[model samples]
Target: MMLENSKYLFDRAQKFIPGGVNSPARAFKSVGGTPVFFDKAKGSILTDVDGKDYIDYVGSWGPMILGHAYEPVIKAVQETAAHSTSFGAPTEIEVEMAELVKRMVPGVDKIRMVNSGTEACMSAIRVARGYTGRDKIIKFEGNYHGHGDSFLIKAGSGALTLGSPSSPGVTKGTAKDTLVADYNDLHSVKELLNTHKDEVAAIIVEPVAGNMGCIPPAPGFLNGLRDLCDAHDTVLIFDEVMTGFRVAKGGAQERYGVTTDLVTYGKIIGAGLPVGAFGGKKAVMDVVSPVGPVYQAGTLSGNPLAMAAGFALLSELQDKPVHYDQLEEKTTYLFNGLKKVFDKWDVPVHINRVGSMISVFFTDEEVVNYQTANTTDKELFRDFFHEMLQRGIYLPPSPFESWFLANSLTQDMIDKTVAAADKSIEAALESSKVDSK
Candidate 1:
């Protein structure tokens, strides 16, 4: 209820950091409030600098699946730091992490480590183009693949949060090459492929789109993309930066039963650290760097600390695979509860969920793509955001972002969140009416 300290911190941060946050969305500009500066997070709870506690649903934007400050990840990082940090040379842990990732993620036989999802995605597109001898790539409008120049066209996440899906500074040439498609719509993709034909190199997608509020592919949509890619010789790349490891050990590829030629991973891979990777069949990956002419390298690509943290997290996930099951149960429970709350208030809302990723739009229209998602009432979302924050429930500050659930969220936490939702929904409904007047 008290945000005096958080307000002071934000004021100070604004002096140096742009918008009082390193990330655009963290500024809470969309939600209309001073962003809470978290002092610490343990398990599923976050304690703000103002000493207010909240059940965290953002999960550090999808990397804290096993929960914040997970012991194994911490110990691994500390142990690795004891020996050394970055060697600028080969390490066994890198090989082990790659192997573990390949084993956990189906269809990946080789991999390249990178510092962030943007790097991995940008590198993946390069490799795809090099291997296929093509120039164009297709990506869904609302499915974010990071800040790569090619991916900035109609990108989501922070881009959407700041009301600039098409950022400035991206060259016209880069934008021209990156073809935009609609999520869950096979016809849009088909039209592009039909026109471009052999010129398109890869069709990248988030199989379970999280950037535009956790919208899952409509039935047979993924299969349609795979088939189209196969027929046209376009590489099917799954940008699983958010869904990888969190949705399942094998990720959306396994969950949806559709395999891709190359898969990019981040988020849970580093257990909240700065790490990302891309991999697939050896024949395709062989085109990268030392194997062939397609060059992609990172100085901190496989830094010891990130590799150790990733390895520790992946190892635990492999051993205890049911973490996803628990996550799904919790998410489903929360989803149903929120739906009930919305129904009680008679609020016009739509929620999309899969596994632990979920989102609620303040619109009655079904959120199938970027166009429909934009139809949501942003003003209503701002009110609901503040209402929930007042009651100690921290959600994604933007409506278009997914609510990432951590495995550490207990039944009691879910209950408390549902109770908060009931009040928040009522308040949002009243606020929307006021705004309309």
Candidate 2:
């Protein structure tokens, strides 16, 4: 594909925006080459600034589960914007959105809205500390809970893609309190709890771990965490920023049949808008401001526009329970297609998928945790990503990130994506052979 416009724009963007992109992943550093600037997106396709159209699989990092520029969400935003945007006061729409969330999510009784996933996670931890009266917290190595100062230690996704899991500027005091554990390894967490004991406030995790390429908890991992937390009086937190509403109606807590004391939500909840929320049992949530002592606030926390879009999206989801079924079928179809195609070429790739979230790791070893996920042949993945891009497919620009499937993708779109992967697999194979020689 020609990239005259995109290339020109990227050059200009670099002069103004650091590294020519607002987000690190958009720089395409992990996948190689300049990032394609999108002009518009509709349903399952993204059109680049240069007029090149490609099947979109990233889905705006999981918020576009209903697909880009969904009619209901767009219309709701438009209609709500006309009524005035941010009042900085309480709104009925906010209550409606909260009600919908409480009804859909398994354990939430009261929710506090935040501006982004990062804020939601950061504030949730503070609430857990205040509720439990403990200081230390345990987080998994690869499960990113957004860029809260504490979470930046051994984080995944954009942090890992940029070659720095431990970002600088985070204080030593913050890092000391944030203990690291391995994902899918109950023993690791057990060891942390054994050492920290009563000092641990909460154990937070990405229930389906989309940041490190969609690694699900090994069989009994989540259950084990719940048990450990209960025994130790530690709060269990599910960071469902990516999995909430995408994996299941009640999020990972429902999908995995596990209930957490607190859950953080983002992405899909906003219906592609910038919104996030955290909530749990009423007792714990009452600790938040206005109701209790722990304070947190945001000007656009429950903005009318965000509430309207989210309400429309959730209403459609709740009304049409078949949306989940359709997503699973489509995802399975694509998963099986990729598996068959890669196996036929004798490629040793492990694809991890749960619900609509998935990722193809360029490794023969099973990717159950951060260590295994890091063993992927990143150069091979870069080649595969570029090849897919050339074939009119827009994948997550980083090897570590998961590919999110939107409900708007048709069977034809999935088939086209599989076809592109078939070609891309061969390209990756050739590149591997050349590197080995």
lDDT of 2 by residue, 206-239 (tens): 9999988989878989999999999999999999
* Model 2, backbone clash pairs (residues 3+ apart or across chains), number: 0
Which lDDT value does model 2 have at 392? 96
Once superposed on the true structure, which residue ranges of model 1 sit more than 4 Å away at CA? none
Instruction: Please report, in order, the local distance difference test score of every candidate based on alpha carbons.
Output: 0.90, 0.91
Model 1's TM-score against the true structure? 0.98
lDDT of 1 at 190: 91
Against the hidden true structure, what lDDT does model 1 obtain? 0.90
For model 1, residues 94-191, the per-residue Cα lDDT tens digits are 99998898888889999999988889899999999999999999999988998889999999988987788998899999999999998888999999
lDDT of 2: 0.91
Q: In TM-score terms, which candidate is top?
A: 2
